[model samples]
Target: MRKMPLRELAERAGASPSFVSQLERGRTSASIGMLRRIAGALGLTVADLFTEENEVGHRVLPRAHRPELPTGPGARKYLVSQRPLRNVEVYVGEFDPGASTGDEPYAHGDSQEIFVVLGGRVTLWLGDQDEARSYELAAGDSIEYRTSVPHRVANAAEEPAEVMWIIAPPTPD
Candidate 1:
């Protein structure tokens, strides 16, 4: 859909192009980590890969049908937006104590993003080490930032935390 070459996608996802080719051909299965990396590289949430093209007529999405997005250890996310993706995409995220997106921050495409803390507290780390800024957000707090900025989100409290992620203009593809 993005007209991205397999090699390029593989390079971004940190996998061999041949492996990506095999996976695309249904000759191989991708681990959760690989799937997450591929989705990120393509400027998409992992669950976007499961959206069926023929679901245009549906008006309601049942909980049983929601796609679970693959995330890092101790963290889980679910796709909350309908597909054939429009101007925005949403995800509901749950993080256990000390859970985080990763140890390192990452950046995506040019889209903008909003992160809302629905429960507990979370720390939002923005930029690289030298210029990093950290915001401790409690329930009901939210932060908006560019998706292209290297950032990471982590659970700041010992208890579980819930968050909502919203991104605009859905990446290119």
Candidate 2:
């Protein structure tokens, strides 16, 4: 597969270089308008960007079959469903105490995220918002919010915090 620098792609798409970088890194979310522009520039449909091409008679993703991707200095584990019919992506994340995804603020297109805290405390910062909301979440505490707003997640406890996240349309290129 051919890959392009985010800056070049963003320039071609008339988007900010930083914004494009964030999207590529999955550090920020994008708006619907932004996604359209990017998809157009990349010669891909939004669905094509988010969905994996189907193979005939493919088996499901077993619990142990999910690939783990790096999430900054912390661990963000994920499992894309075996069935390709779903429109959302599910991730299981674990953060060490005081670890954050990044310090930058990012925005994305028409996406929603629901985070269920499995243990410890989590601090969330929303786009340009001055105040950071801290939640002392246990096994069942959940918070759902729009992904369009720039946001960041951090572990604010002495122990590792576990979270389950679901994002719509997935993170874009």
Model 1 spans with C-alpha error above 4 angstroms:
1-58
The candidate that wins on lDDT is: 1
Instruction: Enumerate clash totals for all models, in the order shown.
Output: 0, 7
**Candidate 1: TM-score?**
0.66
* CA RMSD, predictions in order: 7.1, 10.3
What is the alpha-carbon lDDT for the whole of candidate 2? 0.70
- Model 2 C-alpha lDDT per residue in residues 1-173, reported as the tens digit of each score: 22556776798689999888878799999888888888866645666557655543656777677868667786576665433324666777778888877777556654688878877778766656566554456767888888787777887678898878787655443
Per-candidate TM equals: 0.66, 0.58
Error in Å for residue 131 of model 2: 5.3
**Deviation of model 2 at 69, angstroms:** 2.7
Looking at candidate 1, what is the lDDT of residue 164? 94
